[model samples]
Target chain A: MIRFENAHIGYDHDLIEAIDFELPNSGIIGLFGKNGTGKSTLFKTIIGLQALRRGNIFIHHQNISEIPGKLLAKKVSYCPTQILSYGNLTVWDVVSNGRIPHLSWLGKLKTHDIELVENSLELMGISDIKQQLISECSDGQKQKAIIASALAQETSILLLDEPTAFLDYPSKQELLKQLSFISEAGKLIIVSSHDLDLFEELCDLKLLLSHHKIITSEDTDFNKYWDEFTTKGLAK
Target chain B: MTTGKLTYLLLGLLLLVLFILGIGLGSADIGFMEAIKSLFKSADSSPEAYIIQELRLPRSLVAILAGAGLAVSGLIMQTLFTNILAGPHILGVSSGASLFVALTILAGSTLGDMSLPFAAILGALTISSLILFASRMLSSGTILLIIGVMIASFCSACVSLLEYYADSSALRSFVIWTMGDFSAVGKTHLPTLAVFVMMSVAICFAFSKGLNALLMGESGAHALGFRVKSLRTWILFITAVLAGSITAYCGPIAFVGLAVPNLVRFIVKTANHQVMIPLVLLTGACFGLLCDIISRLPGDDRTLPVNVASALIGAPVVIIILLKYQKSIR
Candidate 1:
């Protein structure tokens, strides 16, 4: 379980303030917000890339700030919106990098680690492209590869920021389906995207960012909350 | 064997041949067999043995050290900044060394015979510390790169101004040093150069995993549980030590650092540092030996500068790589 207590997120002044929420251990929590709405900042804050301005976050009752970075990596994996294309790294090489936290000081991939990397590629249905260079992959393939890397981390919590930004319509739907399957396997996934209609179809819970606050809604009434959010001019 | 293993084997064999060749062919006319035989004989056994033991061996070893050191330094900088164009000299470490060397040469050297290398190292470390300080204040790698360029330009300008006032002999010697040569390191200084380069290379290998993680950029590496800030600092320090020491001994040997890593990446077709690091070391050693041999020009006593030979080879390779990847680069 993840819980936030009066968390203030941002640099300098708070972009989002007084964030208090509790999320179940397993579900797809769709984070919805317009551009520049602190979605990325919130994700960054949770992953410890950015500090909380005011309060605290707890993962499984352990304060996130107290969790060492290596330990936190085992608990939470993050996939950023844009992946810098390291020209010569193949899909397998990129995905295996997710196993860095679990490896020894030399970062050698043991047999088990290799198996996990293979499984991540298999899960994302990109096993065939494992040998292909990431720079040569299509947008959809690259997105899958990036997500597969996060999966290879084997974390309980995965956070994705604007994952569908560059993906085509069908690719986006496919990626959402993959996330849904991943969540079903007993992992908590918090994904941020502007695709509200897709979130309505797939997400188990919806969290909307409006007026520097997070408003939560159950799956059954997410459409109602989204409608209210959009119609009330709060999305702007 | 797999192609990767095959390529490694081939490169290793090539490096072996070049190592022996580097010892064999120089201003002296020792036959290849004689050179190989001299390797097992005592230094006092013969004139050829004495020459090889005293002069050729140290020179070739220095070449290997400088090549491997500079190449690995370039690789570290390239990965840290995530720019293909970055090299050992990118941070003005070489220029810093040059500035101090220039001062020592032009200012009528108060310090004795060891002054130039000492000054070079001091200058290089000073610039490295400045870059490290600036890195703390500025977050962007691109900005740091610009700062490095600015530092290099300032150092070069200082060097030029010093050149303007020096007497003809001092100016001529300074110009020759700028052209670079592998023969400057003798038996006495070989151990120091070897230790610095080997230590830096070992440290680099130890951080190969972190370097590979950095391929994802800083935030991505952080998410993977590596401390990006500390890693960057370590990389800078290693680059400084490697570049500083190599430039101190070899007088700013150019192009090998910038070209060899790119060539290895192009051949290996992978950015995994664990695989690339060793390959780069061997390729760089071969490249150094080849450049040294070319500079000597086997039949002729008049030797060309090592920098001219390296640039002649490296510039074309860099150009071809750029043209081949022009679309992506654009």
Candidate 2:
């Protein structure tokens, strides 16, 4: 379980303050917010890249801020919004890097590591494209490759920022389905994306950040606020 | 054989052939058999032996070491910055070394035979650490690259100013140093340059896996549990030691550091640093030996500077790589 207690997170100052929430331990949580409303900052804080200015983050009942970087990596896998700039890596090579935190300093891959990488590629249905360079992979294939890499990390919580960006409509739906499947397999998957209706259909819960407060699907007036948001967006 | 292994075997054979030619076919042509025989004889045993042991052997080793050092350094910088244009000199490490050496030459400071090398390492470390610190403040790689170029130019301006104030003989010596030479490396200094180059190469291999992880960019590598800052620092340090030592010993040999990696990558067709590390080193040594042979102007008393030979070869190779990979550059 990941818990944020009165967390105020941002680059220089608070974009969102006094955030208190406990993410569902084993399910897909879709995070939605308008542009510039601290979604990325919140993700960074949870990934342990940014510090919470005022409060504490607990992971499995332990304070996250005190966790060492390598140890933290074993618990959370993060995929950024942008395609990685490296062009030379093959899909298999990229997946292999997911084992970095678990390997010795020399990064020698053992039989177990190789098996895990193969398993991840198989799980994502990217086994056929394993030898393809990342530069050659289609948007959907690249998205799957990235997810496979995250899975290869074997983290309990996977954080993806805009995983469906640049993906086609059908590819977006397919990716969300895969994400939901993975979540059901017992990992906490938190994703932020602009595909709202699809995200809502697939995610087990929603963490809606607006007006400097986080409102979850469990809140009493959650549907009323969600309908108000839809009306506001449609009115705009 | 696998492409990587074949590349190594061919490069190794080429380096051996070039090494033999480098020693045998100088301005004064000695027979191949005589050169080989003299290499094993004591330096004082014969005039041929003296030439082989004292002059030809050391110069050949220097060429190989400098070439390998510069090429490997360039590869590391290119990988670290994730930019093809990045080279040992681009980060101002070489320029900083040049500035200090220029000052030492102008001031006529004699700290025995080791003054120039010591001073160059000091200057390179100083500038590289500054760049490392600036990298923390500047998040963009492009901006950091620009900053490095600006620093290099600033150092060049300082060198020019020093040149403007220097006397005739000092200016001449400084100009020759800038032109670069493998021939200046003597029997006494070869061991030190050899030690430095070999040590840097070892460190690079030790960091090879981390370097592969780094190709994914900083945030990506950090997420993989890499200490990006420390890895970058070590890379800069290794580059400084390699480039700084080579500059001190051979006077800023160019193009080899910037071009060899690209050439190797094109031929080998893989991004695995495990394969690249050895290939680049061997290819670099071959290139250096070839450049030295071209510069020697066989049987003539006069010879061209090895730096000129390298740029003559390296510039075109880089241009070709850029043309083929234009879309990848940005």
Candidate 3:
């Protein structure tokens, strides 16, 4: 379970405030907000990439700030929006990096780590292209590679910032199906995306960012709440 | 053997051949067999033995060390900044050493032979610390790179000002040093240079995992639970020590640091640091030996400057590789 208590998330100034909520251990939790609505900042705060200005975040009943980075990595994995394409890293290389926190100092992957990496590649359906350089991969393949990397972490909570951004319509549907499968396998995934229609069909719960606050709603009530929130111009 | 293993074997063999050639084909023109034989002979056995064992051996060893050190430094800087153009000198390390050497030479300091190397190390570390502080204040790698370039330009300006006012003899000595020579390092200074360079290389190898993680950029590495700030600190310190000590002993030999790693990457076609680190080290040693052999010119009594030979050899290889890998270089 992840819980935020009066959390203020932002750099310098709080882009979102009074963010008090508790999420269950497993399911797809859709985070909905327009641009500049603090969706990414909220994700950053939850991953401890950004500090919580005025409140506490509890992961599995333990305060998140108390966890060391390596330990936190085992609990929460994040896939950012922009992926780096400069290095000559192969798909295998990028995906295997997810095992770094668990690997020895030399970063020699043991049998178990290798299996996990392989499984992630298979799960993301990029196993055939494992030897292909990420720089040469298409945008959608790169997106899947990044997601597979996050999956290889085996973290309890996965935070994906626009995982479907570069994906095509069919790939997006396929990814949503994979996320559903991953959530059913007992991981809490909080994904922020602009594709509300698709997420509505997949997400078990919805959290809307409006008026510098996080308002939680059930999947059934998401459309009603979104309508009220949007009609009121609270997104402004 | 697989292609990767074959590449390693070929590189290792090449390095061995270069080492022997570096020791044999000097101004005295000793045969390869004689060079190998002299290694087992006493230092005072004969003029050939003495020259091979005492002078050329240390010179060649220094060449290997400087080459490997500077090349690895370049690799680290390139990976850290994610820029192919980034080299050890990009962070002002060489310029820092150069400025201090300029001060010591032009100021007419009557200090002993050890004073110049000491001054160079001091200047390099001073600049490295300033860079470390600037890295702390700034979060962006591009910004830090700009700051480093600015610092380097400032140091170069200072060196030019020093060169402008110095006497002719002092100016001449400093200019000759700037041209670079492997023979500048005597037998006595070999141990210090070896220790500093070897230790820094080992530390760099130990951080190979972090370096690989850094290929994803700072935020990605941090997300992987690597302490990006601490990693950056270690990288800076290592580069400073390697580049500093080499510049101190070798008078700022060029091209090896900037080109060798790129060549290795282009040939190997992978950014895996574990594979690249050792390859870069060996290739660099080979490059250094090759440059040293060329500089000596075997039969000619007059030696070409090591820097000139390195540039002459390195520039063409770099240009060709850059053209071939233009799409991937960015």
The TM-scores of all predictions, comma-separated, are 0.93, 0.92, 0.92
Over A27-49, each residue of candidate 1 has an lDDT whose tens digit, in order, gives 99889877777998888888788
> Mind giving the per-residue lDDT tens digits that candidate 2 earns over A105-192?
6677899999999999998889998877676778778778778888999999998988987689888777877887888889999999
DockQ of each: 0.62, 0.47, 0.60
Q: Candidate 3 clashing pairs?
A: none
Task: Give the better candidate number (1 or 2) by lDDT.
Answer: 1
State the lDDT at A189 in candidate 3. 97
Question: For all candidates, what are the clash counts?
Answer: 0, 0, 0
| Candidate 1, superposed: residue stretches over 4 Å from native | A218-225, A232-236, B105-122, B125-151, B167-170
DockQ of 3: 0.60
**lDDT of candidate 1 over B137-208, digit per residue (tens):** 875666887888899999999998999988998898788888888887788888888988999899999998
Q: Between the candidate structures 1 and 2, which one is better when assessed by TM-score?
A: 1
**Candidate 1, position A21, lDDT:** 78
Give model 3's share of reference contacts.
Answer: 0.52
Model 3: CA > 4 A from native: A219-225, A228-236, B107-118, B125-154, B328-330
Residue A168 lDDT in model 3?
90
Q: Fraction of true inter-chain Cα contacts (below 8 Å) kept per model? A: 0.56, 0.34, 0.52
Model 3 chain B poorest ten-residue lDDT run? B109-118
Expressed as tens digits, the lDDT of each residue in B100-211 for candidate 3 is: 8889878785323667767887788788778767766775666777887899899989988888888888888788788888887879889888998999999999998899
Q: Give lDDT: candidate 2, residue B268.
A: 58
